[model samples]
Target: MCGIVGAIAQRNIVPVLVEGLKRLEYRGYDSAGIAVLDTEIKRVRRVGRVAEMEAAANEINLTGRLGIGHTRWATHGGVTEPNAHPHVSGDLIAVVHNGIIENHDEKRQALQAKGYQFESQTDTEVIAHLIHSYYVQDRNLFSAVQKAVTELVGAYAIAVIAKDQPDVLACARMGCPLLIGLGDGEHFVASDVSAILSATRRVIFLEEGDVAELRRDQILILDKDRQKAERKIHVSDVSLASLELGPYSHFMQKEIHEQPKALSDTIEPLLEAGFVPELFGANAKELLSKVDGVLILACGTSYYAGSVARYWLESIASVPCQVEIASEYRYRDAVANPNWLVVTLSQSGETLDTMEALKYAKSLGHDKTLSICNVRESAIPRSSEMVFYTRAGAEIGVASTKAFTTQLLALFALTATLAKIKGRLSDTQEQSYLDALRHLPGSVQHALNLEPQIKIWADRFAPKEHALFLGRGVHYPIALEGALKLKEISYIHAEAYPAGELKHGPLALVDDNMPVVVIAPNDVLLEKVKSNMQEVRARGGELFVFADLDSHFSESEGVHVIRTPRHAGVLSPVVHAVPVQILAYHAALQRGTDVDKPRNLAKSVTVE
Candidate 1:
């Protein structure tokens, strides 16, 4: 995904766009660029982080009342200054785009035939020229945008500004997120609400195929047919304080500590109703009665949650489930049985791959699609048959912690509900699982208490450039997530292997300098994990264990243990995940890496 910000105001809007781009940098940060239409014109772009873009802007006079900015996650071209966003046409039509143009080859060829030269090898550059082409024919900015967008086929949330129309901004979206913020004597457009949270809280989420004309004091939305449409202004409750790290050193650390509250918020309603009625709503029992199998599509942390969810579905609901990375899942010629329920998970609710996968499934005549997301009115939730909201409340960190836990809790609740509906789990068994779920909040709190100790462990191990993570069964995915977090923010080379796979090939990498983190929670696989730990210890590798406090585990010379509260095997991963996240955060902070905005990584993968 790419982050886009545009503003039109009575006063200079370059500063507002710059600040908004900084806040939205978590979305994408491979390259950053901004176009400001001042007295004549100004464009500043760089092939690095936002800091470099800011430095370049200082060397140029970038003062304007109309501006558009972008932080890019490269897709169509390599990460270079020329491929960076805020693509400008020769006629001063500058655009900041966030999605892909699927038919760019044909469109670019046609534009080339028309003698419209191109600069960057990006699908997005075609839009600039197409808009310019249409504007030349129609002599109207909004009409040209509408005509150009109608001719283009694919997902996009584009904001375009012409030097001729410096006081007006044209924006449109299709299968991607865009928001318009209302402010006094100013108007704003961004890919998400976070960009404009500092400037205004009142926002209007633009729908798919909707075009908006933003002026200094007004925003008008129009449908594909050019008819004026009404949009509701939603007041966001996200305060500036929630976005700040406060006492924590980084956003990842703050988010790691927020897992307890996040889980409680997502689980309390299900616990009170004794079932997952909210996920299915009017057809809760009916939908479960007809379901035969499940397919989970997700990416990154959400994918790990799906892996854990598959175990829960098999154990609790007795449903055969498969988890797939959304990007690959959509391209394969896979069969979707009519009885299979497809569930997609995303924290942003605008993940491009996952949303496209769901659409592809739906296009194959699958009517039962469910989405679990944090945003209330995001594209994924709006497209699904049912939606489960995760109340994690603004996970700003690129590496997710609270979102993963809440997604697991949501899927676990769904599994329990399916079991209760299918008559698979006995009353005692259901109550036992329910009781454990009820006590999860306290268990999570206890796990959070281990943060200080984990920070100490991090300080000891932060000097190491590489690490290894190991686990078995459900904890296997937990270990993978842990390793991913470590590598994502800390810039440490880490690999997660199934405990049994250690002897296969990974054992060759273990040494005295290697730090191994094991998910050794007491479960049926506890002995197996311990065996793996012993194998590593015997090889002189430093070991860090997150074990159940009541388990028969004792401290060894090379082993460091962060004890977790005792819980059932089904919920141990949820409890054990907290320490690993904190460990990564602390390690990243110790290494002086940007924990909130990692390199070459975006919060949402909106462009495949």
Candidate 2:
């Protein structure tokens, strides 16, 4: 969940490394550091934001043609300068790493027995010492990094630079992402492509167990077998402007307001050509036609999106669907069906638990795999048999906004395709659903216009410590997502339950001081949820209901009705996802919390 940036250029590399770290700050960090080979290995570290390190770095006037930088999210150590990255060993090797080194304790003791004193309480420190031990034996920075990676266990993406070898830089990754950026008379390494997008768009994505050595003129890569390998170079389409905040105060606000464009961009192609299995892949039709069930695997907000999809897949396609959290999917033994289609979802497509779960499912003879993700070149999509990308652009906020909505749109399209393939969807029904997809952008725009009123509610309800969200049928998952957003960004304790389950247990949590949120769309479950709302009001719990325009609800004593725009049937979740995001965004603002980067969270969960 950290960031790594490295460069070997003709000019001083300090500014470039700092700029790279700045771009990665949205990924989340508690400490930042940079190391450079200026005559000797010079380093600077701070326990706060990257700005703190930038100021500390400018004071020393560190200069070098080779450098590495890191923004660390504490895993094995506390948030202190000594535990920050760019861990040094004997003043020879400087290493910056992402992901966990699973066997650090054993290796740390071995190094200590050999008289190598550690300077930090990080698993990354062992990486630097392991490389130092090999460097002294062979005196080759590239060879030392290659040997050290094989001796280590668990997932990691690392960049290394040596004091003796100032012109060369080395990097390797296993179960984590790393890429090489090619520039004129320069080369770079970064965990994310956006870090080096300003420097060069020409990049190479390293595969599992691939190691690379970058120099000023040439780049060399070796395969898992230690043989020379050839990898394709890709030109990225991510613009520098996408990474900027532009006129918005925070990235969550910008991304929340950008949902209309993001939703339209994601489903534009499907809207033009209509739903077809060939849109996903050439063989999608043949394989999907034979599948009997669907198994969805994801984590966090993506998992909630899958939860919404479960309702669609079962009703539309007449298929049994099961959604599992990726972290626990492989640990339990269940009936594995060969005819079940396994679908994996992720925004970064590099979630460690999801990737390992996908691999585990494949090992158990589930061959029909499809990936829905934002990054087209990410590891999960590359490992899957077929892939669909959501055009949400760059979601920099640690609390996801646009990515969750776009995933709902894509999952809806899949439901339609499966329904048509199974003969459950008639021609007229298909056209009606497609028409709703066409007007979804306008509906979401209408929802975003209610932000002023939503903010007012946020300010009034910001003082509460506990909240309850209620929804039924398809909207139950949306309520769960609402609770997650509030707790993660606003730091307010919130829980969600189906409207019918309130009498069983959650009813006791309701009191005069508690605020209960209700998601009531004009569907079959609207009457049942209204009864649930009254039960809350009867117990002195204030009601904040997000109702459709036609629902005919008014603001009365202890009840607040926020009228939402008219939404298409079955597409209501995509529209309802907006206000909850706005509620959480403004609530965090009222609480004086970091709205973009929350505590103990990162944009990409690259480590388990």
**Which one wins on lDDT?**
2
**Candidate 1 residue runs with Cα over 4 Å from true position:** 47-62, 77-80, 216-218, 224-228, 426-431
Model 1: worst 10 consecutive residues (lDDT sum): 276-285
How many clashes (backbone N, Cα, C below 3 Å) per candidate?
Answer: 0, 0
- For residues 62-165, write the lDDT of model 1, one tens digit per residue: 68888899999988889999999899887569999988999999999999999989899899999999999988775678888998999889889999998788
Superposition error at 226 for model 1 (Å): 4.9
Q: Judge candidate 2 at residue 137 and give its lDDT.
A: 97
Q: Name the lDDT value of residue 242 in candidate 2.
A: 91
How high is the lDDT of residue 439 in model 1? 88
Runs with alpha carbons beyond 4 Å of true place in candidate 2: none
Q: What is the lDDT of candidate 1?
A: 0.88
Report how far residue 417 has shifted in candidate 1, in Å: 1.1
- lDDT of all the models against the reference? 0.88, 0.92
